[model samples]
Structures are given as structure tokens and as C-alpha cells.
Target: MSEPVKKKAVQHLLVWMPNWLGDVVFALPTLQALRKQYPEARLTVVARPPVSEILPCHPDIDCVIPIPTEIGKRALAQMRFAFSLRKYHFDLAVILPNSLRSAWLTLLSGAPRRIGYETDGRNFLLTDPLPVVKESRSIHGSDYFAGIVKPLGIETVDKTYPQLLTPDAIGKQRELLKRMGADPSRNLVIAVAPGASKPEKRWQTERFGILCQKLVKDKDAKILLFGSGGERELLDEVRRFCPGKSAFLLAGLNLQVVAGLLGNCRLLVANDSGLMNFAAMIDTPVVGIFGPGHPKTTDPPIAPERKELVTLNFECSPCRHRFFKECEPSPNKKPFCLEDITVTQVARAVDALLDRLA
Candidate 1:
């Protein structure tokens, strides 16, 4: 049996946020529910520089302490960071990541009550360890994360995604679009994120280009291609297919700027990735092209109607995230599931979503 907790009694709550941007988004509802349950408690989140930099300004979060992102010295940095958390005297700590290091950090923080899912051989470190799904992504990631706080009495997580965009963010993105020669205020703006963490997860670049070209010609839309600095080559490749068109390469911008720009867009078309999740969270309709991995794992509660997923659901469909690493490509050297998804399929999805919004 779990220990009883007075909902409003918890103070100085510490949350160890997940590393992945998508994971951070999925984990937010749990925190949101906690805020309602413990309104008087001061909530603080610990995240890396990337995740910390992009988190929206939320009333629930009183403070955000960024730990170091130096990969070379990660263990040592976390150990030091954990030691530093002792002074805050957090009344309770919620560990979001399933990694052992996350659990170890909570243990070292000396937080009297620590709660997290039991996995990665770190169960012994938590004061309350919850049962983990056999495969973390076997179900919705948000559900898995929301369940982590059950021990603390946050039982029912609402079927809603957090509102991630602020007025300032939306304004900044609009301004950026203007400077980039994009008339966002007057024209249809569609965001295209062509890069995924795994190459296996991405749809064909040529197909993305075709979709961009179609959207630009049919809807008279401005295309903003979003990606990190490293993905410049990928976006560049996507542009080659949309030559002499409205598609503008927006590679290398920070997540905040990207989110801001995305908010100005009428819709986003992308493969299954954090950016797709980000766009959906911000209330921008998305047409997600997925294969190899199932959307069931990370789909938000109320996002099904707002976003459309294009998957062939092949016989060998949903090899899941694990299969991304060991993917066996077709003779064309593309994932069979994704390669079969035509430009028309994705475009229709985009049109259906946009039409509904219209």
C-alpha cells in the first residue's frame, strides 16, 4: 500500500524532467495535475540545458534549475548536481526518466520521498517504485509518465495536452517570419520538419519536397522547413526538391524560436519526431508520417482528431523504437513501411486536418 499524502501539505516539490524534448512534453500533464493537487507547494524542475531552454513559462513551475549538459562528464556532473540539491530540502522528488542515473540522482539528493517507475535496475533507490510497462512505449508515453505520480495521489490525469505557446512566443515567431520574407499574417504558412532522430523514422525527402511543392502551389502557402543546425544538409536536400518555390530553410534555430515560428504556421507535416509532438502540443494541426514505430506510444490524449498519422500498418508494422536501430531496408534502401506512404496520402491528411480547422 502507498503512504498517505496530504495533497496540499507537500512543499518544495522537485521534479527531474526527462531529457528528450518529446518526453518532456508528454511528462507535462502529470506536473500540471500535481499543480492542481498541491497548489500551495513550490514546484521546481531539473532538466538539461536543451530541455530547460525550451520549457514554456508555466505558473505551476516556480523555478527551473538546469544541470550541466557536458556529455563527457555526465555521471560526474549529475553526481555533483545531486549533491547540490540537498540544500533545497525538497519535500518530494518525482523522477521522470527511466534511466538508473535519474533514480540515483534522486537518492543522492536526499529527498525523503522519491517516486518513479521501477525499471533499469534502479528500483532500490526509490521510496516508492511503480510497476513499469514491459515495453515503455508499448502504450502512450504520457500514460506511463502520468502513472508515476499515482503514489503521491495524482490519480486522474485529464485527457489534455498542456498549452505550450505564450503570447510572446507567438509574436516573436511572427516577427521572424516577416524578416524571412514570409507573409505569415496574410498567407497560409505550413511548417515542414524533415529530420527525425533516426533515419528510419523519416519519410523520403523527395516525398516531403513533393508535399511542400503541392501545398505551396495548391494552398499558396509559405513553407518553413524546421530542423537543428546539424540537419542543414537534410533540409537542404528537401529544398532541392522544391526549387524555385516558397519553401525557406529554417535550419539551426533554437527550439523556442522554432516553436514560435511553428505557431504561426497553419499546419505542420513531419515524420514521427519530437518536433511533431511539439507542434501538436502548441495546438498547431500536424500530419505525422509514421512507420517502424507506433504512434500509440506517444500520442497525446486529445490529439487524435487534431493530428493525422499516415502509416501503412504493414504486416511487419510497428517493429517499434527498438527496430529503428536494426532496421532492414527494402531494395530501394528505404523502410518499406515509410517508402510505401505516397505524397498524396500525406497531403490528403494535411488537407483533411486543415479543412476541419477551416
Candidate 2:
């Protein structure tokens, strides 16, 4: 609780970052609060691999240690990673994730003070475990993260969106884009991330393909498809529907490359995923396509006026967000929540966001 911070000085602080990209972005404010609470303490963040690649780019963070979140038949990796953290001599560990492994890692790190939300039966592992956040439409994702640091003397968390990429890096990505055949200077670049982490969250790539071509014709925009290496098949599926000259497939590029390009783009249209949160974190205009998850609770609350969400009013529209098994799969096997959303609705949302930006 607040007693630890009030009693002794925090020399080196360990901030265990969330594994999911969206949750990682949401926790930025908590990191900011921690930095403010212990101005001179060494702040370190440990997260999973791909997202871990970009965490060091932020100015507030002093160090980032990459750790494996998956323990599929082997936890030797987690043990080695945890044993590696003990040398840092962290006086306090702020566990962002509610997983038992997260608390166990903090315990293994030999940190004297460990704090996190009391969930996943990991309360016994934490020194100051707070109450778990309640579910409500009014409570935003950022609030859940901000609540984690309140017990540590951080009264008010800064909700300002941090610039994740430097201007030099963002500017350098233009050459990379030009080499890839996209001219952001000549054409208004609209980056599209058609893939989502969860199957229930992604819109049909065929609609995404059609929407890209329409944007090229109607708005004279150049489409840049962003996705990880694993999403090459999905990226290819969307590019197959796009015009040959205008749309470019950018699968398998570095996350920083995508972030830099997102920093320079006119706007980003993505399904409800980490890339959507990434684009918004770097201050890009985002048009997020919502399916089963309602934007009210799932989306970040920062700069609501600058962002737009498009979803239907179906009875099962805002079903249980995580791994939604409630809805019957469509005949084509696509989840009904995402399959029902038409391309026209998405285009209208994109148009409205662009118009507002203009």
C-alpha cells in the first residue's frame, strides 16, 4: 500500500508489462504515474517478444527486458528469465498482469515489495494486492490500468497519449515506404490492419479489400496493409481484392516500421486489435471497426473526439467480448457479429473521421 512508498525510498522499480498489445498500450499511463511517483528510481519494463521490441522507444521507460509469456509444455524459459531479473535488485515490482506467473516471477525476482490486482488466485503472492476492477460500460480500459498504481501514492494518472516513435524514425520510414511502392507524399496514405488477435474481432478481409479499392477510386488514397508475419495469409487475402497499383501489402515488417509508418499516415483503419491501439498511441487518426466488443468499455477513452468506432445495433452486438462463443457461426464460418457489418458502414465511418480531421 501507500505505507511502503511513504516509509522508504524506491531505488530501482520493476514494472511488469502486460503481454497483450492493447493492454500494454493501456498501461502507459500507469508507467507515467510510476515515473512521477519515483522520479529518480530506475524504471524497468518486462514484456513478451514482438511488442517488447518497441517498448524501449518510449521516453519514460529506462529499461525493457523481454520475457516469454507462453509456457507450452516448458517453463524453463520463464525460470531463466525470472532468475535473470534478480541481479537488477528491484526494490519494488508492479505486476501489470493478473496471471499467477506474473506474481510468481516477481517473487522469484526477490523483490521486497510486489503489488497487483487480486485476481487469478495470485493474491497470496502479492504484498499489496488491490481489489479487482468491476465490469461496466462506463469504465474505460485506461481506468483499469490507472487503478493499479493508485495505492502506490500516485493520486492522478496522466491520460495523455505518449508519442511512441521519434520524428527521425517516422521520417525515415518514408524511404522504406517509397521502396515498397507507396508514396505517402503524393497520395493520402490510409493504413489498414485487417487482422485481429481474436477470430471474433476481425471483419471479413473481402470487405476490407473492397473498401481499399473504393478508397483509392473515391478518395484517391493509397492503402497500406499492416500485419505481422503470421498474418501474411490474411494480408494476402485483402490485397487480392485491392487495385494492383494503389494498395501495397506490408506483412512481416518490423513493428517499429509499422509504427513509424502509422505515425506518418493520414489515418489508420483497423479492426479491434493491438494495431488499432498502437496507431492511436502514436497520435494517428483511427477508425476502429467494432464487432462483438462495444467501444464504450473495450476502447481507450483518450481523445474520443479524434477517433471513431463503427458497429451494428444487433441484440448480440456487445456480447461477452473475450472468445465470444455465444453467437452462432455464419454459414461461411465467420462469426455473425463481424460478418453482419457491411463495407458501406465502415466506409462512412472512415469518411466521417477523415472529414473531421480535415
In model 2, what lDDT does residue 108 have? 90
In candidate 1, stretches whose alpha carbon ends up further than 4 angstroms from where it belongs are 71-73, 300-305, 315-317, 324-327
Task: Give all candidate RMSDs, comma-separated.
Answer: 2.3, 2.2
State the lDDT at 162 in candidate 1.
Answer: 51
Model 1, 264-356: lDDT tens digits are: 988888888888887888788888888876777766333567888888877655665555366677665678888888998998899899888
lDDT per residue for candidate 2 within 47-83, as digits (tens), equals 8878798888888899988875475436777777788
Q: Weakest 10 consecutive residues, lDDT, candidate 1?
A: 315-324
Instruction: Report the alpha-carbon TM-score of model 2 versus the true structure.
Output: 0.93
